[model samples]
Target: MTSRMKPAIDIIDQRVRHAMRQVTGIEDCSAIVTPATNAKFGDYQANGAMALAKKMKTNPRKLAEQVIEKLDVSDVCQPPEIAGPGFINLRLKPEFVIESLRQMHSDPARLSIPPAEKPRKTVVDYSSPNIAKQMHVGHLRSTILGDAICRMLEFMNHKVIRQNHIGDWGTQFGKVILALWHVCMAIDVHKKSYFKNDFERLQSNKDNKNELYKICMQIRDRHDKDYINDQLEEFGDAKKYFGRFLEKLDDIIDEIWPDILLAYRFVNLLDDILPGMGLRIITREKKDNEWKPVERPYEHLTRKITVMLQQGGEENCQEEDAWHSVKKATMEHCDYIYQLLNVTLEHPRDSRGESFYKDMLAGVVEDLQKQGLAVDSDGAVCVFPEGFKNKEGDPLPFIIKKSDGAYLYATTDLAALRYRVDELKARRIIYVTDSRQKLHFDMLFAVARKAGWARDDVELSHVTFGSVLGEDGTPLKTRSGENIKLRELLDEAIGRARSVVEQKNPDLSEDQKQQIAKAVGIGAVKYADYSNNRTSDYIFSFDKMLAMDGNTAPYMQYAYARIKSIQRKAEKSGVDVEAELKDLTGIEFTQPDEIALAKYLIRYGEAVEMALADYRPNFLTNYLYELTQKFSGFYTNCPVIKAPPDSRRQRLLLCELTAGVIKHCLRELLGIEVVEQM
Candidate 1:
């Protein structure tokens, strides 16, 4: 394997630290080399000498001079200068900058950056959407953020396993299956549009309790009748209607998503309203190999069905089939959003949902019990990981199984963690979720460690992010206070971008405009999110994100397009631009803008390292934004296409390298598309 190239800053830090070790006869001293705070100081500064002086109780400036005597950075930086308080300021030589640029230009794929020295098998769990529900704005952060992390890790040559831990099993699936049955009966049996009509009516009359109650009663009565009648069929409705419906489900799968959503709402409405209305529904249970009818409260039907699905027998095959169909359809919908966002999550391959660990939940709880880490607390199986407490100053219980014999998220997560570690051999497991789940994961990791499921050497991280807020500083939602569906949000972004593209460059072809619009629209959304501190809430503003200025995606993308335009213009004027850059022997920087841009270009690796250090993408975004600003200064101050013959090739090289870095960062690392034209 080829050795990875260390960043210029890393090389400098090594050299400076070695010099410090030689001067003070102390090993393991870090130079703490950082970029110069002010441009006038130099490109970088070593502040370790002052700290070392403090440790040695000596004059700082005098210690700095001694360290500089042993520093041999003449090959990379000019002679080091001692600044105030013993800061060692170093400036990169022009030859060094040129050589770095040449290395980047020669290797367009990686830009001369190599993989890590020791790579580990890593698993990233993110974008976990529930079965039978459309992905909403709430999932946007985890989906894209996790994808970016995976891309960065893969770029560093780590063994990355992208796990889409979808919510495929739970109490919710029972309701989802019930909703599917309603859809089937509404279309195949009654042959009416009751689900859609009732959903709209329920929404409009939600504030009117009397009217809502009346509607719910009417729907409840019909549902009861249908349930009783369906059970009359041989082998119940499980084999009669639902099984056949599942057989041809794919034929109308695309058309049923809307119906399924409406039906789900219908079921939820009934569950909320008909609870205390003295409603009863007839369901069945198989006892002694004979079917027996039982009366149950209408509102609790879904829960009863959930118990049946969990118990899983020959009698509940229909419920199991329905569960599978719903999960499949939901993931198919999620895949569409994944493609639109350029995320890498796919079904079956990367998707390992809660259902995958359904059988293991009991074993997880049992093993914890055997280890004495889990105990019965208030009739529920719980693990009281140390340091977690409630407001009453009692140890908070991390509930694994409810008193009703139902496993919760904590149980499923434990199973998944064990599988990732023991089966997948993952050295590091990262769970990307919102900040609200911090306590859950803290206890989870603690319990896993206590149970010896995840060893101390195995790295487990819960990467949390703040919610995306609307202009009102609340979580982003629709006007109706519903979670905004991601598909609709992305489509609106592209639509708005199209209008902007139309206003800016109307002469472009329709296809060209569309391509640019999609790139700009989606890129703006992802970039805006990535540019913000992951732990801070940011307002989702399409107008600001789409603006052609500042640190937005449009600005960075436009910077890239402008560079490509320069190359195109050069090519049109009978200039063999590639040939000229390839034939160049050396670059002499005569302009301040050239030097500034060249210096920032070589620090791309440092930016990557910083971003990866804390798993904060804002660092890399901040770097790209500054690089674009530097390139703008260079472009304005020094003309690339019309420069004098002696400097034209140098300027052209700078433009090419700038474009390459921007494209690689945006398209490859950030998963955002870059266009060649506005």
Candidate 2:
């Protein structure tokens, strides 16, 4: 089979293609084969005749019947029937459906899905939060959605690059640097006053020349020592690698002045790394009147991170190692998202941000200008391309420089693009960003094409998405004027998830609660964003997402959980699932719900392929939700426990298969967890 054609899929395609050719005498008519909008009809339906009815000079019902007479789908489907208003309803043979599911089960990949014909290298930019700030709700949607997109693309065999693109450098850095400088200055002033007069008076009261000399020497020695430089370098190396330990130090002699001050400064700065860098600081006040201790801000921050990371809800680790563990723990957290989402991630590359490209930005601009694709207008370099116009009907330019000759976002983006295309030899550059920057991206893609940095074969696409709005219909927010933080939002979601799981499945142990919370919380948030059309804005709704019915993550998860519960009972009873798989039988799909459920399950590969082509998870999400609903109806109507052995085995197998499909879809499409019970 060609990569595009699976056995069952090809059978359906051939049936439609043949019907179009025979009835319309036109081979290229657009024929849509979709699940029946309402399940009252057969398993699948094609509405190709509705549009063709006008052109063919015949009634839609008559044309559909004529088309159905010429169609051949015996290999994978029952003969087509003409339904109401020109709909070609299709029914799959139950034995055939069972065989298709069996074939999918036998395949190691579980869906019989194949990779793209031409897999190309692609770059995905996502989850780019600024350093030293908490990762807030402002960043949550993009991080989860973009990561899931990249994961899906890679899972389908594309060479994907995950770019964190942290905002490590900017004018903001200058602000932070100024902040740190003032803090250091104040601490130094306090240290100087404590040492000068206080030490001299202590020495005067002692009164022997030798004792005074010793005191002077001790004070002199203390002021000249430095241990912080060694500590900083050690911290950097440990965080970078997954190593057991950095070399430990034994106590040498005690010193008083310089060492203490230097250590204090380093500790103060390290406290800022908590929310993002994954570190904690703990401190206690000094009882001595002359020596006041620093407050334990780091410890509090570490506790917050620890609560998120530790399985048992404990926030205890070695102070020196807690920083490294938190960093490791954050990565573990990111990985759980990947696992739940069922996508692979590239080894993360820390290339920093726009300022990291400073050395190359100027050169890129010069090259664009030299190629005649860019020009200086009002002291700013811009690219004017064809067809794009402003509201005033003037040609719009993608700015590379501002009026002050400062580099702009477009320029940095172009430089990054050029580096990826020319230097990295990338075949594709897929940018995943918010849809508001559509014009910016369109301009960049056009200018890059004009500048000879990219070609049509080297794909450059901006996978733009809509804003995540709140219930108020603007953008999401708390009652507070400030933008809701990602960390805070996640915490709230997890807290709610914990309560939901506890109430629903109170029998789960503490460990299960923690694990399920991570899955449910993150899954609910991700599914809320991904389940809708990505190009359109979706209002964020916690209650709706966590609800037990209709196109929600929990509903999908609950389906899987119910199936798992059945499978577990079967296993406990020592039922031989594989041995129960039998060959020939009377095709027994009497119920419409059974037929509907079977049809949805068989289209698994097609849904994945559609999602892969469009880079839209909603396609798959919609498919899975329908599949779950159909299964739910089937389960309610068809009793499994009281059925005969052969039928019970078949039902169990069907349940097992449905669960597998749901698990795969949830991870691949929405990045959620499947609770065994709930």
Candidate 3:
């Protein structure tokens, strides 16, 4: 007696393989058993005979018949049919399907899908938004996609380490630090509108380069004068006061994220206005038991700050404090988004971003150079990985370091790769990012492979996804052409769902309405993205995803709700669903709908395995959609509560299993929530 339900496909696959091996004397023969391409063929088609016959230089149909002569699937499948070109098709016996389902009902936790025979540790890198910046629509695919991959892998018993390789370090972050400094000044001594005024001026003059440059320089001057005047002694002090303020930043993160965003934007505006304009800011450095003033260029201030923060010392105390402060605020923002999206990227543990690799970057490059994989190109340290070339056919260089000593993203990525391999013991590393970064990852992976950073057996995959587009079929953006904020999009989704809920089912309580609206809204958004082929661009449509029909999340959720509602009605009308399903030994399916639903329900594991193999969630979503449709048909044909004794037990079991499968698919696997009621 098996402890868990074994999928009928697996049984048929094994039986067919045994039969083929017995006849052919090929002990290690494979039965390429897959779900039939279409229903006309059968439930599963074993195409291994064709491949074996081709390999053995024999007639395929002859080989199929020879293998079929010894095939003993009498208990599980009907007589095997050798279709065109030795395709051995096997259809499950109705009793076998019912028995397989009975086995599944014994253990509900695993849902009949056994853990992988050999599990490996996997590192899933995804959902990496920049620090001090609001998450945008661009992060939608990677976050949920990566999370789903993790869920699937973990479900398969693999040790999954989720790495949210966020853009928390680099030039943008340096600018964010500068912005935080302004926040510090504004809070401590300057007028409340000081940053506000500068930010507005910066925004207004964005198009006028000359005007923007002038304003940036003026802002820099004002900042310099303010630092000088902010003195406790005759010679003004900058670092001492700033360091103290940094220490107290944690208490104010909630109050200042909006300001942080504005300040970060201001930094971008400044960088835009003056591409390489030289300006300087004073930071405090303690030497010989004295607090002394140290100056860094305005253009390179952030870089210098980043290096110091990365390097970690008494000189970088304030910068480190500010860095941690900014990270805390940004993580809080991301947590909200994660909660809304149902992603499981936990903080502190799963999050290892670019900043985490900052210190190791130089070492990664140094090791590559030592191994002769990286070499000096012009003035930058570069690895010209083979097969990559420019439009002119020149060997493209993956620059690790600039002549000015700044580390590139390639350097940090390489560092992260090495860390994942060595420390995490990751046998497989999956990077989830936009398709635009495909080339970068290609170069990075090639360089890592050349440098012996990754083992030969290790699987390094970059799961690239396409962009989310708007109604006009362009990348999703606001009317002002700015990237749509994720938070705003979520709010709009919920608002739209509320409107829908009001129109569709207005009698529910306010709390129930809100609950349904949130589940439907967010689920719709995620399902729309999941339903898309990750490699193809998709138009994000609220009306379409939110529709309570088709292959949408709302549709799946509503179907689950309908099942639960029926179950509730069954109980209310004196039907003991649990008792009826307490024993599945005598269950019988009289209706075609029941048979179809049972067949589809058992394929859930197959869907999970397929999605995990390709990192494609659509495979799972498509399976769920089909399963729900099957359930709908079954619900219509066989009544659970009102059916005759022979049918009622079987129908109730189907309802329970359908609801379980839907919940697992939506909430557990895809990170989409479902409500009990509409």
Clashes of each: 0, 8, 1
Winner by lDDT = 1
The digit string of per-residue lDDT tens for model 1 on 246-356 reads 677767867887888878877876677776677777777767877888877878888877767777777677666567667777887898899999888888899899888
What TM-score, over all chains together, does every model reach? 0.95, 0.73, 0.91
Q: Point out the worst 10-residue segment of candidate 3 by lDDT.
A: 232-241
Summarize candidate 3's per-residue lDDT along 1-678 as a digit string, tens digits: 456544667777788889888878889999999989999998999999999999899999999999899888899888889999899988888887887677667667778789898999999999999888889998888898899999999998999999998888766766877788777777777758487888788777667767877887788788777777655653334554565677888887888778878877776766666556666667565578677877877766667655555566654555776788789888888988998887998787778889888878778878888888889988989989999999999999999987767787888898999999998899999999999999999998898888888868799999999999999999999986788999999999999999989998999999999998899899899999999899999998998998877999888988889988988998998887888788777766767898899988888888888898899999999999899888888877777777787777788888888888889888888888889988
Model 3 stretches with alpha carbons more than 4 Å out: 14-31, 51-57, 187-192, 220-224, 227-237, 240-244, 276-301, 307-312
Query: Higher lDDT: candidate 2 or 3?
Result: 3
RMSD of each: 2.2, 13.7, 3.1
Most accurate candidate by TM-score: 1
Candidates sorted by TM-score, best first: 1, 3, 2
Candidate 2 ranges beyond 4 A from true positions: 1-10, 18-27, 49-70, 83-87, 169-173, 179-347, 350-352, 582-587
Cα lDDT for residue 10, candidate 2: 47
Rank ordering of all candidates by lDDT, starting from the highest: 1, 3, 2
